[model samples]
Target: MSVHELAVTESVIAAISMQLPDSQVAVVHLEIGRLSGVMPDAVRFCFELAGEGTCVEGARLDITEPEGTGSCASCGTSFPARDALAVCPCGSADVTISGGAELTIKAVEVTDDV
Candidate 1:
């Protein structure tokens, strides 16, 4: 288990636990971009253990990974980027990348028993 992912999952669980102190969390929706420097698999692996005994325990974790978008400064063309160093089809090296590197909690679902 990666310590980074474990710590991140712990924090996420703690936040959910604090918000829904008495509720049983049913799901957690998250967005993790491809270039976010975070490994989705690692986060998934850490979720269960990190959420143990908390509101997030046993909750389903859903993650979405947005692809990297890049815009070429030279050609003004926007395209998908496989990596930070992606070159534009126009052969432009001056590219600005975005839509990758996202780590956010989009939503949370809880049981009515709370």
Candidate 2:
């Protein structure tokens, strides 16, 4: 088993446990950046294994990929930047990343059995 995905998935479980210690989670929503270097499928698989016997056990992991964005310092312009190291639209390499490269827990669904 790869440690990378397991580590991240464990973190997610820990975070959820902190807030909803009593409730059982049914779904886990995560926002994955296109340039975040994390594979959605791999994370999902790890989540299944890591969540065993926990509140997130058998919970579905919903991963959403947001579009990458950046801004040009020279031209004061903004555009989509799927690649973080991509150049600016004004023929300049001076581009600042505005979005993407994110791995966040968006939301969680739990039954109101409490």
- In candidate 2, stretches whose alpha carbon ends up further than 4 angstroms from where it belongs are none
Give the winner by TM-score.
Answer: 2
Using Cα atoms with residue i matched to residue i, what is each candidate's TM-score against the true structure?
0.89, 0.92
- Model 1 residue 27 CA deviation in Å: 0.3
Error of 2 at 26 (Å): 0.8
Tens-digit lDDT track for model 1 on 18-106? 88788999999999889878899999999988888888888899999999899999999999988878899999899999778778999
Global CA lDDT of candidate 1, please?
0.89
Report the lDDT tens digits of candidate 2 across residue range 11-91.
989999999999889889999898887778889889888899889887888999998888998999898997979788788
Count: clashes, candidate 2: 0
